[model samples]
Target: MSTQVKVKNRLSSTVQSLKPSGIRRFFDLAASMEGVISLGVGEPDFVTPWRMREASISSLERGHTAYTSNAGMLPLRVEIQKYLEERFSVSYHPETEILVTVGASEAIDIALRAILDPGDEVLVVEPCYVSYEPVIRLAGGVPVFLKTTMENQFKLTPQELETHITERTKAIIFCYPNNPTGGTMTAEEWKTLLPIIEKHDLMVISDEIYAELTYGRMHDSIAALPGMKDRTILISGFSKAFAMTGWRLGYVCASPDLLAGMLKIHQYTMLCAPTMAQMAALEALRHGRSDMERMIESYRQRRNYVVDGFRHIGLTCHEPDGAFYAFPSVASTGLSSAEFAEKLLMEEKVAVVPGDVFGESGKGHIRCSYATSMEQLKKALERMERLMGRLS
Candidate 1:
């Protein structure tokens, strides 16, 4: 009888059932509070590399404001092809295999939507990027979470995946140099997964946005494995490495058949990624390697500092292999993940994401991004130490 009831009825059950992003909620709350030091949102604290920004500006000056082709500008796609092949040892034909999307986020949405039919099941690794399960549900697919343990360094095991697979299982979404937890797999680790994937004939949607941000060793893309090129749809973008988050540039590389289906969805829904963003991406590929190196060097330093800081404060932290987060257990404090995060925010004005917000396995931990400056990280850590001392 009420207008609110009518509006609620009109909303899709899928949307209604979906939980809001836990990361965003804390980040927003931190934003509203003065002097809150945030280690919550998984974003690079750096500005977009100047060359990429200048390239976009030059494109605007040249009046390149029109929408690009549905697949994106040829030059940008070519550069992306070259970059991926050279950097990751995975090759995709620029013309047919790549489609630039608004961001990797959009690429993820369309990839799932294009492949999934009603009731198909998708295996999602736990403590993943926040969007995976909700997007699967939105695509009319069932999301089956496979828990990854801290004891195993949060890397998804083929054995764990095998336990979760069933007749309805269609695909698996994997992220490495993962979010929430900065776990990564070596090429040898990927080799073990190859047979399981082939035996099950499962499609792979590999999200490698943080590939370039690894420490010590270069990122190893699973798509580089023999026989994987056709079955894997690789999603990545300039947002992480190039600090071009606001540019909304990303792309997906897949076999032509799969790409065509995703492009069909992309063309009708998004038309094309922004023309200017494509130009910037082109420039980033051409000239941004050094910029990425500098940022990575800074992150490596920060990572070491954050990890040591957590340990010195008497919390158990797994040293992240890549990405800019230190996921430390607050279990010694005798508090739940949410309780620890909330109390830290209230008592110390430091904001870190609650681990369980990522998945059930993340219950005793909190994700603290080291993306901020050394000074800020030091201050946040000091505040955390004070909180721990008082509690102790």
Candidate 2:
């Protein structure tokens, strides 16, 4: 019998060093416990609209299981082009500038990988969606996190943005109708930051995943601004607004050259997004606006209730103008964010994402999703108030 020799571990250093997603950890804990009310995930609670679902089903029924062009189905791309022009005032040649991706997640990965070289720096504003920093590291780029504060409603100031740029800085990822904080920026705010971007010659990776869900104002895409179309990589998907998370369909729009580079990487890796999903997304663009608007209005009402509930429970919460989360400071409870989250799950059967997982700036706060039903949000708030009472 030959003896097998023990080999040295050979996982990639970057992948090995990445931490597990904190949002998923708490969510799994809640899943294991009986009767726990979970507010950990950022996903919408609604099902994909019937028209979109029927479109996907009809495509599947017609045996449309074959792969599309790596850039995705041409019809879907064309519809995307029309949607972008009509809604965001950004125009791109559907044939050359749009690369349909598996999800906005894949769009972010391929966009960064296409542009970043080893040791290149990407300024990442935080507290952000948990994936940005890790994705940057995986793409051989350094992530420089610019932490935003609650006092400023978590919007990144021009001075703070300028202070973080250096010669090595190549791009900046900005998300609005932002994750975790639900912050939205006006066109004027975008204008305030554009001069610095032009001076630095930095590429903007704008993640507008929650664009349609904003309250009190329309979303402003930096790509829509004069002279920015060539430098901005605009990313969005049908997941949030159309309630199609499991559909996993998204697209990236950029100048032809930049998109071509990303397409080369995507060709070898993803090849193409799902044909059924593309069909569904096409239907979403054409006829799903009314459904999306209804969901947005529901989210707006829930957002108000959740923020008020948090404040009533003695936690300081800023009004979230976009997205479906309420970020509330738990500093008065005298417990660290993680401690509060763990204890709340164990003792009160309520699960929330600890804010610190987003970034250091998010410490002393917790993120509660208002995406669930109103009854559940009320129940979660009552449980949180009970937990606060115990802590006191």
Candidate 3:
């Protein structure tokens, strides 16, 4: 007897207008299949290290379930401060400069929201991480993409960067040992970028989650450069290096004024990162260095194997100097990135992400995570080769 109300567009206009994550769409497709080999996910396949897990367990036993300060536990922030200084040569006052969050994802969100006002613009470097654009839009900032190409080794050039800046551009989201492409910039490269950033008076949201995973060269931070420290928001976590994705602990470091603004937003939205995760992250900074190194070595080996595998299979892959992904060109197969990926999944049962998911410049390629076991990597490569042979 009751009349039910039907709503066609109940979501916010922005939410409705925004596209669903291309990464998640492929993941959902892979999840529905019975025999798919997924290279679609960006997360590490490694488990949390035993000591960190044990630290969390012990904290739980010690009744650390109570909420930490909105800025997070001082002890954890202290350890984070130590780790950043020791690893990347950047120092911050733990008590005022660091705010722990649920994950690097949350760190990114709060940093954007704290800085952006309505109609402001942020320059997003791409082919890059997937989250930057959406987070900027959600923060009421316009995302002006600065696209990178394979010809440039997927590194943003000084010329390319300046072209994208506008008077309205308030910040730049910079990520490296980049996701999707696995590209990285050296200290010299950072030096060239510094003047442009300084000249424009841009605030940098530097996502260095993949910092510790770099190959050959030691990691460098933009925040470590002469006068860049105060203008940079440094975001990183234990998820990649310590194999603790599920632990979901991350931190953001910035000047006291910027940090205070971010913390206010974080307090209202996240309260604090999980207490157990904080305890585990404290353990990560204190004693998990060796474990982190071991995991990075493993990732390095996997990176070599997968990149070589792609090359052997006749796909042109840019050697990733950092991160656990290989961006291989599928253009020779005469299929669009989406077509190549979709067909590979249905026909060959190997699930890869289309490169364009990262940005328009990524269109002729595909992103394959090498974080999986060597056995799976081998099989996936063989299947891809077969698909290529058939297409040819």
Q: Pairs clashing in candidate 2?
A: none
Which residue runs does candidate 2 get wrong by more than 4 Å?
none
| TM-score leader | 2
TM-score for candidate 3, residues paired by index: 0.97
TM-score of each model, in listed order: 0.97, 0.98, 0.97
- Model 1, residue 235: distance off in Å is 0.4
Model 3 regions more than 4 Å off:
3-9
TM-score, model 1 to reference: 0.97
* Greater-lDDT candidate between 2 and 3: 2
lDDT of prediction 1: 0.92
The residue pairs in collision within model 1 are none
Q: Could you tell which candidate, 1 or 3, scores higher by lDDT?
A: 1
lDDT by residue for model 3 (1-392), tens? 99999888778887777888898888898899998999988888878888999999999999989999998899888888888888899999999999998889999999999999999999988887888888888889999988888777789899988998899999999789888899998888889988899999999999999999989988888899999999999999878888889888888999999999999998888888899998888888899999988888888999998988888888998899888888999888889999999999999999999999998878999999988998999899899889888988
Work out candidate 2's RMSD over C-alphas: 0.9
The Cα RMSD of model 1 versus the native structure comes to 1.8
Superposition error at 278 for model 1 (Å): 1.0
Whole-model lDDT, model 2: 0.93
Q: 14 in model 3: Cα distance from truth in Å?
A: 1.2
lDDT of each: 0.92, 0.93, 0.90
